[model samples]
Target: MTDERSSTSPDEQRSDPHDSSDGETADADATSDENDVNENDADGNDNADEFTIADFHDASQQEGRPVLTAAAVSRALELSHEEANERLEALADRGALERLAVSTDPVVWYPTELEDLTDRERVVVFPKQREIVVDRPDQFTRAQLSQFAHLADANGEQGYRYVVRPADIWGTPHDSFEDLARTMRQALGQRSDALEEWVHSQWDRAHQFRLTTHEEGYTVLEAQSPEIMGNVARQKLDEEHVHAPISETEDWVREGSEAAIKRILYEAGYPVQDHRELESGEELPIELEVRLRDYQQTWVDRFAEAGEGVFVGPPGSGKTVAAMGAMAHVDGETLVLVPSRDLAQQWADAILEYTSLEAHQIGQYHGGRKEVRPVTIATYQIAGMDRHRSLFDDREWGLVIFDECQHVPSDVYRRSTHLQSKHRLGLSASPIREDDRQTEIFTLVGPPIGTDWEALFEAGFVAEPELEIRYVPWGDDEQANAYGSADGREKYRIAAENRGKIDEVRYLLSAHPDAKAIVFVDYLDQGRELSEALEVPFLSGETPHHERRRLLEEFRRNERDLLLISRVGDEGIDLPTADLAIVASGLGGSRRQGTQRAGRTMRPAGGALVYVLATRGTREEDFARKQLQHLGRKGMTIREQAVERGED
Candidate 1:
């Protein structure tokens, strides 16, 4: 029977090969014949030959052992005996299976279940240690181990021993101890102690706290470790009696509190990192067109030292020039935020004349143009718009100069300050606001850094002014009735728009024919009527922006000695040549407006004159007194002069 079986047809030999003794070969052939008979009986198909790894896995699981034999797989999958044996060997090399007992006639294979691997089996076969166990063997891949082996061999390093815990080795979690050991061994192959140094560096980074600037003008404190956040919050409560809610990821604070918070964190011994850094600006020329005055130089030096603050100096005391000097000192990408388009243009002109920036480098961001450049001069109105606000989302300004920053108390105007900058400078003649929101400026920018006006005047940096109050009687009884009956805004309008002030404006212009004068009024209609009656150029909110610029230029060139300007000209418009001013109307009890109107003629051209016109024996008298009181606080004396009906 053995000789006949060995000499069996080539087809039978190919189906099930036996290379052992006659009795063993007969047993194998009997088993193969039994498997064929069982398969044919179960499915009645003799030609089916297909198998997969999943079939072997299922068979091992059902048998309650990690072991699966070739004959069992062949019967379960209906594949040829040779095909089953080839597939089993392939799976064992892939780490999915292991050769359990090779001494047996038919080698017994065991499937390697990463999730269920024993401690002994989880140990890597490296020569460094007898026992290096992996906690989770399921998280590692075979490719990772292979790469590690290749990298270690390339570096000519061997016998790596891992002393760190598995959790610490990976810095997070890993499934396979062998794979993790391989990766660490590979990383350390470059140099000795490299893996230990890397783990320590990761721990330090994960524990550190950092501050990042958000688009909404707030700073976010990022803490990756929950334990660190809890520690910080507990310490804050103990020291300051404040309960700060701890977030696993981050906390938020106002931008204004960034300095204070950083200081607190440092004092508490917390490792704090400031993620905000000053961006390197484009290089500008060091030379300046205009030399800084003594006081201006002092102001610039102080501003550079402080980095950010409100600079308070009277008009014509070189506040704008001092700001220009500060910009030159910093020599970075600058953004000048002004309250009006006229001031925006003036800033643009000042930048071009004083600094190395060219016309192309200086862009105007307003209604007409939204060009962006290294230096941007924008009005608050344009910067407050939703579309324009988005333009600054990613911009990092090196310096931000807020010209006439008193306007920042308004909700819409305050939006312009949402931009992030390394340095900030607020320039204002009178930092006070009518709404008593000066504290907002201190919080958003910084506290006031003042320059003495009286000192400047004594030093000849500012021109002394001759202040006068001219009282004009009402035109008729009908005007008196309207002023008496109106309330709220109407009463102020009626009082300010008294028709008799028109004659007073005309007289001031004729009296100062050779002296360049600016006629300032509170109401647009009053300014228009006076401009038409006196036949002079008028500038108001309704005036086209380009035309307004042309008119101011014409006035500067001596073509028009007298120009009629409304309250829009009260702040930030530089009329240095104007030696005389006629204030016919004003917002009631606005100290800022009164001071700005007086400052229009404060240029250093020998001396200047300011004539304030008020309606006699009415509420205008009281409001005028208030304006004069504000000017008096600034060290100006006013002489009252009564106008007869035909004084003009």
Candidate 2:
């Protein structure tokens, strides 16, 4: 239970009460004049003695009524009556203290020069407790009080308050403030003790049994225990109330007996939580055997040590395998998040093969799959739909693994950002986004703990694809006549499916006849046309998942030479075979997209071949150049050529 109380700042209370009235302007002028006079008086007091609590109290007794008698003043200062009386008169003359009443029976003094009564009052009330009582009932109403009660209830054991009004309940004068204080005391009956008990229970639950002294230092207890209880415990010795400092509590807890502390906590209504640590002579599940590559091992170590961070690599860098291995090491549930439906199934199937765990223990939640695993793989799309329900359902993930973390910058991604998880591991082929929202990702997720595609390729973690940029010249008639009504996408599609390029696709197919060649196109229409012209199978977003899997399996087994694929393969999809790529269409100038597309061939199965066919003298070439720049900077020579010799 957290603390919820009206802890408004003293600055807020000290604001002028007449600020809303028309006379505020005149009051401000008067305050300014008084401030100037005070400054002048201060300047003239270079030789003046410093004011003491004695002088302040003497003057306070003089205000309104006799708050203090001469005998009380002598007792407070531990001085002779004549000596105290002479000192009081001297203080009154200097304006440090003033006489309140006409009769000198027992002249009480008050600090008349102190305009800010609240600060002086706080010095009396709070002192060493680091607490302040506002005692202002005029600012709150009945409904507000009820609301405050509700807030206190929500905050549970940490809330405390007292409310009082002037009704002569304590047999004191209405203007004396004693009746008001008595009412407040009645309202707050036993609340202070209740708060102390609550804090003691929390510390006992932390399982630190020793009641040791804590010096002044901040302590961050992960949970409640006896050491913590000791910190809050108060003792009375020789008319003094002494409490342990926070530092002492920390040291005592560190050396305390765990069992004794747990017992004390259980007695105090705070039971010790069972954090399942591995025990001696207790064999773990035999099915937990995991085999990891060197890179995967590095990632797991990094995640364990860093707590929360990202892991980046291109396709086939074994992100899923590393994540699953890390999950096997955790005691609680693991939640794996992927961007797309196809990738979700791929991950689930992969997890099943890696662990000897039951099929039901490895779950799948995505567009096309059913969720049944204790260690579930959920899609970001479904998780982002209705957040309150989703967050409530999946708040217990021990390790949250995000696949394709580049998509985290999207608006929909923020839905899962605040969900509490102590351990997080994000996987991305390319962590960089079109918009520089990497910082937001770092906050929501953790810092990127992995590398990009270029790093993976250089380390031989992935394959090195032979690059070729083929500039398929637009037909001479395309240059003479413009497709005026066509959108940019439509024009690119027309150019991609040009008959000459169709023949060139056949020529590329013929050149890599035995080797499996993938024809990568932009539009579905272009995929269909190219598949028909080359007499080969193709896959697109519209294709059912089952059929798509079957077709990819056949192609991977070297059953198909020319397989046409669309932008659906842009992400981390399984394309085990078909090394050669024919970039039939794409956005110009962004090497990131091009690099991702080319990465399709980087998986070390057979050799890789990239053939980017862009229409000559169009924005497609410019886009292709921009994409090639990222590769060229990484030491990949980008060679360009023309499909058919034509005039510029």
Candidate 3:
């Protein structure tokens, strides 16, 4: 029901079409105004369009109830008679507010007509909740008050109620004044204390809320509900585009969306307790006959003492071997978590070689393969599939080892609250990066098992390689054109695979003629281009998995001195025999990939050389700098020998 024009005042009448003195003009103008209003109404506009007292009243009680009088509602809201009363009736008719006749002469209105009037509202406030009230006594911080107000504002139907009777608040603790303070805060905003004091002093109202001090002189206030204290939550999906499993309940705010709330909860602080409670003296079978290196033993000892932590070891550093050895010495079933199916298969084979451990019992779960037994190697993707439940909730994994510890800090892995293995270990080579969130690896897995990359590399346990970073000039305008797009990957490929890099690769090969080498590229076209230019066999995702393996084997056996591989060679599989790595193209600006690629040539077969070809004066050089920053190199060292003059 829209507002009627019958009660227009003299001021409002001037604007109304019917108020004109010319009788013919009044009817014509009225018809035109009505048509415009009808068109606006058909478009379902309310906020932009003007409303009348009748419209306000009708809007207030569309379901067949008397709407709150505009004059009374306006006075109550303390707005001008016209401004307040004008929209009040229509808002009420639209079910935005409820008309409650508190008195025959003085009517009242309430927002939202919720059933449970005594319900409490929850808000996820930030910074620490404990600190919000710990020291403050005479006053509550603005943040605290605002949080309370946001919660309480929902108590009224439309927004916040200006006045909530004292008797209406229920379930508040005796002598607790936080709820009253919160309510007063909502009504007063920043002027809550004044109103609160006024109410208590003049009206002789009891201060229902109180604060108590602890032995430490910390003021601890009882939990108080928000001003509105209404348990209504927005029906929306989470910020990450993932829907909550329990769609009905409002307890858990969409995960990352409620960071402030989580912070408050964290500030509340949980008691620290050791997650590991290993049973004593009942050790299980130890089958593997493994000779642990001093560094490997040190990693195990640190892991046992640290409770949970990560082990940093480059490729061929025996990270997996050390982890397996540690598992063999410990009792109970071990859970090995790998990144992909290829790694899982590699781990399964490696573990079998170390121990007469039943190969059948060593289960692998990833891709289409499924096996569950005493020992299982599951991929992170499958483990993090169910966000609500833990990955190992149904069963217990005594020792959980994440092969790629860097992945453990990812948001997807963090959501796996069910990965409750207290005795856990993470193995990775390049842990430090630009995205230091990977530092959460400490929180998720444990402290560092290896001190630093250099420590492990120097101790002869991990690989050590001499790095050679070269600038690859672009071929034609192709490289320059690719950099214009937002695709960072293409930018990297363009710079890395520039024709100038082909000459450098040849130079590095000529420089170390006898050393077996593998050229790493990010794109298949780059690899193909390099393969044709250098007359070498190249490997990519398009290459059959078996054929790629065979090609790598041939190169390792000296049948081929050079093998060109795309990013597929960044992880998994092994190249123990390759003594030199030529990084033609790489994942731009990714420090992890840089370290892992460098580690490819760092295997214990004596020290090797690593050459990284980066395009100069482009984003590729910037990415190279970021990758090498953590490598402990303070300055850029390069030998720029242009193979072609003005040709590229």
What TM-score against the true fold does each predicted structure earn? 0.58, 0.53, 0.54
> Can you rank all candidates by TM-score, best first?
1, 3, 2
Off by over 4 Å in 1: 1-286, 587-589
Candidate 3, 494-593: lDDT as tens digits: 6666776777777778877777787889877778878898987788878876787688667655577778887777665555436778888784747778
Worst 10 residues of 3 by lDDT: 130-139
For residue 405, model 3's alpha carbon misses the true position, in angstroms, by: 1.6
What tens digits encode model 1's per-residue C-alpha lDDT throughout 1-648? 001111211101112122223654465456445545544553565543333344565555445556667877766667678988888887777777767666665577765763442321122333232122222222122112322222111100122222343223222223344344435443222112444354445435424676666676556777767777677744562323222444675676654455445445544544344455444355544345666654466568766765666777777666776777777877777788887767778778866766666888888888777878778888888778887765455455678888889887688887766543367788888877878777567446644565445444544556657888888988767888998888887877887889888877777776766677788887888877887898887788788878988898887666777788887787646654467888888837588888888877664444578888888877777788876675554446567888898856
lDDT of 2 by residue, 1-648 (tens): 111112211111212222333453355455445545544564588744434543444344334233556566677656688876776777677766667664667466666655533332221112124132322222211112221111111111222222221111111112223333322222222123333333333333334332322233221222344444454332111112222234543222332233233333434444333222211111223243445555566667766655555765655566666776666666556677777777777777776666666666777776666563457777787778773345326345666777877776688875655443236677765566667655455445654455333334544556567778777765457632554456776665566555556767777777766565677877777788787887777798888888898888776555655578887877746565345777877645244567677766665443667888877766667777776765654434467886665322
Query: Cα deviation in Å at residue 379, candidate 3?
Result: 1.5
Top-scoring candidate (TM-score): 1
Q: Model 2 segments beyond 4 Å from truth? A: 1-290, 369-372, 391-395, 451-459, 476-480, 483-497, 587-591, 646-648
Looking at model 3, residue 264 earns an lDDT score of: 26
49 Cα displacement, candidate 3 (Å): 84
Error of 2 at 428 (Å): 1.0
Candidate-wise lDDT, in order: 0.62, 0.53, 0.53
As a TM-score, model 2 comes out at 0.53
